[model samples]
Target chain A: MGKRLEGDGRGGVEQDLLRHDCSIGEILKQRGVSRRDFLRFCSAMTAAMALPASFAPRVAQALDQVKRPTLVWLEMQSCTGDTEALLRSANPTVAEIVLEILSVDYHETIMAAAGHQAEGALDKAIADFKGNYICVIEGSISTKDGGIYGTTGGKTHLERARQVCGGALATIAVGTCAAYGGIAAASPNPTGAVGVMEAVPGTTVINLPGCPVNADNLTATIVHYLVFGKIPALDSHGRPLFAYGKRIHDNCERRPHFDAGQYVEQWGDDGHRKGFCLYKMGCKGPATFHNCPSQRYNEKTSWPIAAGHPCAGCSEPHFWDTMSPMYKRLPNVPGFGIEQTADKIGLGLVVGAGAAFAVHGALNALRRDKEPNEDTREG
Target chain B: MSNQPKFKRYIWELPVRWCHWVNMACIVILSVSGFFIGNPVSFGSSASDFTMGWIRFIHFTAAYLFAVSVMSRVIWSFIGNKYSSWREFFPLMTDAGRKKTVRMLRYYLLIDKEVPETVGHNPLATAAYVVLFGIYSVMILTGFALYAQHAPQGSMHKALGFMYVLFSDQGMRLAHHISMWFIFGFVINHIYSAWLMDIKEHGGEISSMFSGYKFTVKKEE
Candidate 1:
């Protein structure tokens, strides 16, 4: 790895100091964090990554000796919810410490620099860590109208993404917006926002798509990268397999209830109070892929389904269109009226066919009876 | 009509009739079970009841049978008699087939008082079967895609996960669900047409599916 420090001073000597030379272990030691706590964090990450417990030591060793890599966080057309989720991670102290060890050279939200200085820092970081830094994109890149929909520092998100993500070692699209355009690219998308992979084509983008991505998944991804020196295995959608290999329905706590056909029909019902399955209430868990059931949100407290609200399939692509009406089991058939569902349209066609056939049969009977002497010849 | 000698012609083979009834039974079971899977009937107040599980089991079992029947029928289309040949499905490929199809269309539209008879399926019915097969293909693919979710990391998951690239999970379910109605529509028309032809043509059209033979006038050589 290139360890050269470009000491062009926009900041002090402290900012110029080469922190990449320091291993994660040394930094954690300096921060008064116990070795046991560090190992526990590593084991937690290993477990989160669905690795065998025997691999904990390997993960711990790799993370301990690994040098801090440069990370550049790009916030485009987003709500900054991913960043908030990361800050409120399950193991906040350990996660924050691990994040701190990584040289996050450019982040718009949390960076101390402003205006031109911030822009300069971003450019400098990209230049210094070209082909090495991990670029984490948080929001969708608006591509319509020459990308005038979203611009920062006189540069369109598309332009900035192409430049920054094009050179990174690997790009992690952190939220649904950056992964699959989320709500911003919902129906009637005026901005024409697209995911980071679509915006910066051919770049190795590992998507961690959630409404606000689970901080644990992001943390596990970073740990996996640090430990393995490469990104984890990804699904077809480019999501890490460990975090998104199974449907939420498969691992859900209320799965037993679903199999037992005990569903909460409505809000505040007897079944709801008894912790029945939310399948009837239009839970999208069957369609959604996420570890939210196992790895709960907001510091492992409670996820949407666990809290009696059905999953809105926030992790899925085009979920705003495909996974709605959020309160219904199936999406309404497109090209049909908004209220007309697939079942309604299907039932109508079946009934119409039945009725038409009935009428035709009736007509054939009447014609045959009226013309009893009609020739039954094969022409 | 009284002087004509009626010849018993073998139109449907044993395998053809077997696959037809098998396919029919599977479609009916799959449709009913599949519909229930999509919109489960909430029953049994106790959590011990395995209603959805039983429903899903029936759906999956019917799905496998449907798959096998479809596959075998497709295979038979290659090796079976010319009547059940794969070429028969593509009726628009031949000039006579096109003419027959037009005649059948005219008869259905009441523009023509009579339609030319054939040994095997009429060109119009063959065309409809082709579309139904297309719907069957969509249903099977979408059904397998949905089933793949149950076995993540299994071979089925690996083989069928590409469906997500074509459609979202719920979209796949919708395709499978809507195709059920297409089958229902086809069944309605198919039954009525068969019944009508049996009555008007003096051929055992509906019974031919059961006996694999139809009564036709002998063409004197």
Candidate 2:
């Protein structure tokens, strides 16, 4: 807040100057990307957002005119797997193109600047852009004992997050850790880690939760913001509805096999080799919501199901806790411990109740036979 | 035949009987289909039939019927007659009703041999029915909430989509499954108690649900 760059006020003039000064069209042209390819990528973005074909040109025009928004990516209690996934762009596709559109101010893993220079770059970007820059938070914020678990440039990740996110437009919480505490906040969370929304109260946190969030979703989310000047419409979980709207079971490639009642009971049977439904073997696809089926990872190469492995429900909240044991169906009903399923517990109760009922019925019959005046009661 | 000493009293109305039977059928179908849906067991490799699809269809269809019958029962409780009215569902509304509940509990426990006299359900039965209705609401809400995930946005499915917000979809599924077991327990106990009461009281209690009439012994004052 030191140097308030003509931010909230003079919005129209700032937009015009920013667009005119450093246009994405010029940047892409310098990078040898043609207009037709750019337009095609815009259409792809529109399709990814579940928007109609007519909105493609609008997306293209908005993207072509907008300046590269400054982004400050902060990693807290993370594995840096999200950044690794982003860097592992399988092919020269739309995701890579979108990634290049953002002018990353400070990223711990990728940036050359470090020490005071890295902190200086973050401060400069926040001060210069004010309420216009984007804050991309990866991993969970360790709030235990004043966030001593994670630090950078002599400042705790929590302090740096609050400082940078104070004047940002919106924060994109990338990966499961940043969204819902992922594996870091699983049962007996040692560091008291929490998602960005919990760490930064007022910031509009758009969660793109996954073990290492699908690169396509990350690209689409950023493009949606660059085009519309706001984050895409989110579900109750703060995830973009287009990507996480439908359950993995609903849009599964193995759904036909599931409908036909063909399931792979074990890991290497003929059914498993034939790519049958993995529901029986504890595939959490039915309970999980993600676009991994349509939006396959690694440049449209092969998703988990196509690779003959069951989905782990990585994109969901508390997946580590709820969808554990990875290869089976049904969640562990908390008090039942990790080994027991709800069916097992329910069956036990039902059997016990049935046995008790039979005993009670026999006792009633004996009591009835013992009574001499039973006939008098009935007319 | 004309000098019969028995007296017959009409207890359940037609609407109440219809709702009861419809709900009973739906519960049977829903529970069977629901069990299969959760844990799909192989029924041979029948190439022609879509086993899981048909199972889910039957499950959803029965679920809708169950919801409708439950809703109808709620409406009927307000208008159906004194015997089938909402007041009968809450027997603890009066002081005498509370005493009747204790007496019925004692009767079931074998502490009292004399069955509590009631035209419809005893106070204990009324209380159990009320609790069962609460379980019905949970199943219906969670069922629709799960259905809402596949439904088009802004529809009635979306309107009841708050279950996902309150708990994860699996949590909703857990509630639905647990409630099914509760209904199963209720059904077993209900049948056992009805038969036991009929034999002990000699009031034609079990037949009352089907025929809407119970024969009671006439007493000379």
Candidate 3:
């Protein structure tokens, strides 16, 4: 099926661009992106993918030969934070180049079409690229009351998600909302929001799940697909294993402080000023998984923990429910209310047991003292 | 009935007793260190304190000891006497055993005054032991699964990677954390039950765990 997108060998760079059927490399060349810059991006992507340095050239070669794939981006029940983060990618110029090569046929938030025109564009894109376009969902699907909670273009978000994901080559859930319902599905989820995969079963959905997913990860995922003609290797959560494989704590800049038993006891404390570990400040880095450390946001400028804040484990599944309160360890034990921690519950049980033991022991001692020969009786 | 005097009978073997105490120590260390590892308490300000690191090291060490002791105990269950045998731990396998378990439960509830005498663990205790072992198996399985995430990709990964199918890392962590509490409750109940039985039976049940022998009145089979 991918062969249909291949270009004819008899074409010059200009001809390839005119036909809109050239490899990414030819398109880059046409766009005046030098070969060196393209290769440098490929090398960077290779490193991000955790491939050996020796594979950089191979990555460049693969990327240079791939056709511009069609993409349809759908916005659902979300704040559009992922789109904002994507715009703020480390290399916006490179991001634009990559987005151009992908030929995003229809994107609701960024497209110029309005009302019926936009709906027509979506229908046309789905028809033209049927079974070939990549479906990028940026938000969760609201399935409550037949998806009345979120509607766009006269169709509910759940209906649109199922429709778009149905005929796409691959479905990419681009943020925590689209991946695992994020804040939209947190406790008291009256809207009944669900992730893309849950909204559309029987399809492989690649989850790039950050609160606002790291642009580098989204770029790498698309690049991996463009280069390899398949989804990148995913973890159990359907996230790219290379990006989410290691714990954030393992690579945090303040790891030395963690190992040294130094921590910021309170906000803006001396330890905090000195960049001690944020473990005491309710950092979820120990449990979170992401490449935010090495692949810092905003062009490697800084991330949450790097900026003297603790990680909220935004990249993990169920962050809203599991990693909340932002300043505490352990999820609140259910049925015990928010004030009770696992430690508190456990200690309470231990204490209760001790109390019961004392009372039971005292009762047993009194019984034994009353009847010294009672123990000698047998049936 | 003209009764015979009580006599001491060898029951628990030396290896079984060793496994019990070592496993107990390991569990205590594992629980304390595991809690610390889960929720680290900041100690010093030096960048090279290594307190959490040492805590983790100790936790891992204790975890290994706990797993090994349990493994060795399982192996010994087969070779040990009837009292220490694997079958004794699974009293539900026999109808008679099931009946005794009910009777033991009734005795504990004060519905029955006369308790059925058993040389080793009462059927109720045996069933509880069986469940405890099941919990141990789950803890070990999940513990190794998490450990294997960091292990090199050869034999260790090949052996434990399949565990990924059972639980997500977060789910596994939850299970591991919850299992620790189950064990903690079991230890409390176990000690209390042993003391209660020792007093009621006057057979030195608690002391037998250490001495490998129980002083019981000789009765006709």
DockQ of 3: 0.34
What are the lDDT scores of the predictions, listed in order?
0.84, 0.79, 0.78
- lDDT tens digits, residues B80-173, model 1? 9888999998889999778778877877766666545666887888889999999999999999888888777689888886787888888887
lDDT (10s digit) by residue, model 1, range A77-195: 99999988886566656665656567778778777667888888888888887999899999999999999999999999999999999999999999999999988999889999999
Query: Deviation in angstroms for B143 in model 2?
Result: 1.3
Point out the worst 10-residue segment of candidate 2 chain A by lDDT. A1-10
Best by DockQ: 1
Tell me how far candidate 3 lies from the true structure as C-alpha RMSD in angstroms: 5.3
For model 2, the interface Cα RMSD in angstroms equals 5.4
Q: In model 2, state the lDDT of residue B18.
A: 95
Chain B structural similarity (TM-score) per candidate: 0.94, 0.91, 0.93
Alpha-carbon shift of residue A220 in model 3 (angstroms):
1.6
Instruction: Tell me which of candidates 1 and 3 scores higher on DockQ.
Output: 1
Q: Which candidate should be chosen as best, given lDDT against the real structure? A: 1
Ranking by lDDT: 1, 2, 3
The 10-residue segment with the lowest total lDDT in model 3 chain A:
A1-10
